[model samples]
Structures are given as C-alpha cells and as structure tokens.
Target: MRVGSTMLVRQNLTRKLSRSILLVICIGIAFFVFGVLSSFRAGFEGSEANSERLVVASKIGGNETLPLRYFQQLGGMDEIAEVTHVTRLRAHTAGNERNIIGANAVDAQSYASVYADTYDFNAEIMQAFQADRTATLVGRQLAEREGWAVGDRVNLTSFVHMTQDASRDWSFVIAGLLDGAEPTVDTNFLIVRYDYFNAALLRNQDQVNLFGIKPAVGTDINVLAETIDMTFANSTAQTRTQSETAFMSAFLEQFADVALIVKLIVSVSFGTILLIVANTMIFAIRERTLEIGVLKVLGFSGSSIMRIILTETLVLFAAGLALGFALTAAVIPVLGDALSSVVPDLYLTPKVVATSVGLAVVFAVLTGFLPAIKALRLPVATALNHR
Candidate 1:
C-alpha cells in the first residue's frame, strides 16, 4: 500500500479512539490468559515428563497402603537400581488445627538413594534422624511457618493414623531442618522414620502407601513400569506403576483437573474476543461505506481497499498481543510465588511465545476477512448511496 493509503488506514482505526482501545483490551485479556496458562503447563510438563524414576501403588488407589513386601520385590528386579517406600499422614501440633500438614514416614537410607537427585537435605541431619526412633526432619518452609527448631520436642496429632496407645498423638524431637536445592522446589513438608511410624501403628501394620524405584541405567522406564505392574497383576494386592511425575499428576488431579480448567478458560476467552472484534469491525465498516465510496472514486483498487482493511485489523491485534504478553511476563513470577506449592517453575517460555504469536495471526485473519471483503466488493455507486 502507498504511504497515503497507510495514513488513511491509521486515521480510520483511530476515528473512535475509545472503541479501538476497548477492542485492544479485550484481545489483550485473551492473550494474557493464554500466555499464563501455557507457562503453567510448560513448567509442569517439562520437568516431569522425562524423569526416569517410577512409583508403584496399589491398583485400588495410590492412597491405599500396599504390603511392605512390594518394596523388596521391586528392589530385586534387575531393571530396578534402588527402592524406597513411604506412607503419608496429615499432622498438626496437638493444639493447632489450622496448622495441619502432611508428613511422610520414610526409610531414610533407601529414600536417600532413590531420591538423591530430587531432594537436597543435609547429610548430617540423617545421622541424628536415624539414631532416634521418634525423630522428625522438618522442611525449611514448614519449620519457619510453624516456628520449629532442632531439639524442640513436639507432640503431633495424626488425622489418618491411630497409635497403639489408642490415640492419634505421636511424639518427636525435631532432629534437623530439611531443605531443597531450588527456591521453587517444595520444601514445605515433613518426614519421619518409617520404623517408628510402623511400630506405633494400631492397625495396617507392615504396609506402605507407595514405593519409589529408580531404573537401572540404560533400562527403558516404560518397560520397567509395565514389568513391575505385571508382576503383581494377579496377586492379592495388584499394583499400578508409572513415572514419578505421572503419580504426582494423578494425585493433583484428585484435587482439581488443572489442565482441563486452564484450557477451558483460554478457549472461552479466545472465542469471546474473536467474535467481539469481528462484530465491532463489521459495524465500523458499515458506518464508513461513504468514505470507502469516496476512496474508490479517487482511483483506489479493490485490492488496495482489502489491504487497508486487513492492515487496520492487524494493527489492532499487534497492539493487543504485545500488551497481553507483557502483562503475562510481569505477572508470572508473582503467580509462581502463589502456586509454588504446586507448579515449581512457572514462567513465560519461548515455546509459549511462538505458539501465542502464531495463534494471534490466524485469529486476526479470520476476524478481519469478512469486513475487508465487504469493503473490497462494494461498488462505488452502491457505497456512494450511503451518502
């Protein structure tokens, strides 16, 4: 298009400044939501999909405890390099109901071996933890939140388990502060010795909620996951084994279908903005029929009319898309802090940016085509009749 025509298009877009700004804000909200949700998915999927470790749980449900013997059976497999088991229970200080948190009863040695790459607690902490039957290691976040310190003797009430004393209360000395290597890695939980937990239980003795396993180097994780499940397929306690991340995803899914919710919100937002921008432009074109007639009379071709209309639409989308993504980038860190318990590394990613840009282009074409075609096909006399 000529410089004169470019100037005309800009004038037409800004003819009603308020409408243009409103449409741009509508589009911006859509893309901002899309960008944020895409980052959330990328954060979870990127970190969890390629992990080599596996989890084995009862077919009934991961929360249901399986025989502790499954731990030994998994460890004996040639494809498995290490194994550990844990059962979790919700706990709070005896007098503090609002402070309720979950604690894991774990085998320290086997757990450290299996999870060395994932967990980053102090080595010295384990010595004190192993030496005391009722010792607990408090995660840094949990300790700070609850005002706990090493050597502090605390009594906790378990919501799920009962002790041989016919009560839910358990006693522990805080052996040390457990910590994670990364700021986003969750260090807001508790860990206790499996032996102490088991010996004190009133029922469901010799059981674990799930087992963690590491595949031997070069062993295919999928093959090992299937083999582990098949071994117990016909047993009294059948197993369902999958990647560690898959298990966590399944657990999170119980609380809410996060992926589905994010997708639904984004889809609705994009669909709403597409229709809004299309209808608004349609009316704007109808109102400008006389001006289009004047332009055609001045020797502007149908192709030029089409180009100018489409260019106007592209400009609006360009502004909106840039503003939306800018907000997404600015808000990602803040959202990550809020959701740190769930998504560890939420942020704008290159893949999400590329995808959003591509989607916006397609949406712009679809939204603009009808109005532009209406202008392109308008005969000079017919458009002039509007005068």
Candidate 2:
C-alpha cells in the first residue's frame, strides 16, 4: 500500500514538473535561511561554554578598566588556581589605515593555562613569545585574513589610547598563530604580551582592562567571585567577577537582546515557510480535485486519501530540506575565512542540521494537514457530478 502511494506521488509530481520544481525551490530557500540563522544563534550562545574559568572586570561597566594589582590579590586566594590580565587595544595595521584588528595585551602563560583546551599552545611557541619582548600571537583566522606570518612586523595604531604625537607607537612581531579548539574562543583576537603594554604605559600603572581567573578544583565559583569583589570593595578600582560564560554573555548583551532576536528571527522564518508550503498545498489540491474524486469513486477510503496527500507533501518538503541542508553544510566551511570575523566559529554541526530538518518536517506536516483533510472530505457522487 505504501509503495503504491509513493508511486502515485511520483507520477503526480512528474506530470506537473513546473509546479513541483517551484514548490521545491520555495521550500529549499526557506530551509536554507532557517538552517543558517539557527546555526548562527547557536554559535552565539555556544561562545561561553567553558566551565572552569571566570572574568574579573571593573565594577563600573564593561568599558571601565580594572587595576593590575587586582590580579595579585585574586592570585593570593587558595580558591583561585591562576589569574591573567588583558587590556583591549583597538588598533589598525601599519601603513594600511583602513585595515583594523581587535588586539589585546595578555598574560600568555596564565591565559594558556586557563584556556589550554581552546588554544593549542606548544613549548616552542611559548618559549619564543617569552623570549622576544616584542612578540605577539595572532589568531589563526586573523593571520589568514591579514596575510601575516611568523617574524612579520605589524604596527598597530590605537584608537582608544593615542600618543601625544598622533603616531602609532605599538608594534609587535607575529611569533605564532593561535587556533581555537572550540567555537567560543573568538578567533579574530590578537594576543600580545601584557608586560609590553604595561612597560609602555608605566605612568598609568594601576589600569588593567580585564582579568581572567581560573578557580581551584571543587571551589564554589559564586562564593569565590563574591570574595574577590569584597576584597576590592574599598579599592580605587572596584571589581566585578563572574564565570567565563557570564563574562561572554555580558559582552553579548551589550550588542542586542540575543534571546529575543533569535526568537523573532525563528518565528518569522517558520511563518514564511508555513505560508509557502500551505499555499503550494492549496494550489496542488485545487488542481487535483477531479483526480481526488476519481480515487474516492474507486474505493479509496477517506483516511487513505488523506494519507496519500500528506505523503506527497512530506516527500516534496523533505527533498527540498535535504538539498538545502547539504548545500549549507558544504558552503559554510568553504566560506569560513569570509565569515569568521562576523560570525566566528560558524559551522553546521550535526545537532544544528538535525534540528533544522526536524523544523522543516514539522512545518510541512502542519501545512499539509488542511489540504489533506479537504481532499479526504470530497464526496464521490458530488465530485463525479462536477465538470
């Protein structure tokens, strides 16, 4: 019975090639957009999955700078495993004023120890960085995008903190390329030696932009965070400490309401798919009214007729969805370089693909339900009496 129904659907589609192709195209586009958008949202949220790390920043706000001495205090706690400081330096590459890079001065050893899983740091690279005061480690994606390599000199012009002469004084040699082990460690960042930046701005000795902290095993992160904050309560630079996940979430919140935006986009995309499939089903049922009546007259039960129609709709939607997902999976990796800066770690994981396909199937089933019911309810006698 199922085989017959499948054959019937194929015949119907083959007979009306243009309409079938149009339907497939519409469904394919909707699925493609759905898959891409869903993956992007997932990527955004996945940026903060590290369990053992935390970030300490100025209590005033995200942009406020914290004191470098705060790290020394945090490091003194038995509950704290390690502490590293980072300072944001918004700068452009040398000679090319148009080319911009998001660079940060970081304590490399501490950073590597904390995020060893996300960053593959070798002994040679660490030794080179430690030995050369002017050395910098660039993200793999950034290096590829900018055509940089080891031993290459790149000067950065600071936008936030400029020199009195209006000349960019910051420069570093690319010692190694840093590749993120996961999607969360933003691949567009350049990690330079924090000591270099500190030495350069000795007059501004107290300022450190952010501190990355790793908690000791079995320590309660919340309790330790509170303890660190209380220790700095009377300080000139107040502190705010949170888990690494919360740190990334805080940054994301500054841009937009991520949850609301993701919900809106998914809702709109699903609605568009519903309308497209529903409209296509309506037209298909209208055109096949006489055929449906013939089947009804030939002893096809209402339930059987409904099943056939639903099956056809499922086949069409499935084909389109499969095509779109395959295309997305193939294209996303190839365009990694172009999209890395904008949608860092944009790749179609298995979970993302499965969820997208499931969404398409659900929408297809819902949209086809009405048309299937309409076909099933057609009276044999009445349909036969019509032209």
- My TM-score estimates for the predictions, one after another, are 0.81, 0.85
What tens digits encode model 1's per-residue C-alpha lDDT throughout 181-254?
65545566788999999999999999999998989999999999889889999999998888977887787677
| Winner by TM-score | 2
Give the deviation of candidate 2 from the true structure as CA RMSD: 3.3
Deviating ranges (above 4 Å) for candidate 2: 39-52, 162-167, 182-186, 218-236, 256-263, 297-299, 326-336, 376-387
lDDT of 1 at 69: 90
Q: What lDDT would each prediction earn against the true structure?
A: 0.85, 0.78
**lDDT value, candidate 2, whole model:** 0.78
Per-residue lDDT tens digits of candidate 2, residues 1-387? 467777777877777888788888777777777677766765665553565688888898888898777778778899988878888877887666666787988888888887787787888788888888889998887887888899999788876655444455688898988877764466776888888776776255557788888889899999998998999899888988888777776777789867678778778876887887788788878877888889887888888888887888888888889887877777777665566655666777678778877877788789889998888788877767666
TM-score of 2: 0.85
Tell me the lDDT of model 2 at 91.
Answer: 82
Stretches off by above 4 angstroms in model 1 are: 1-9, 32-51, 126-128, 147-155, 290-311, 321-358, 376-386
Clashing pairs in 1: none
Per-candidate count of clashing residue pairs (backbone under 3 Å): 0, 0
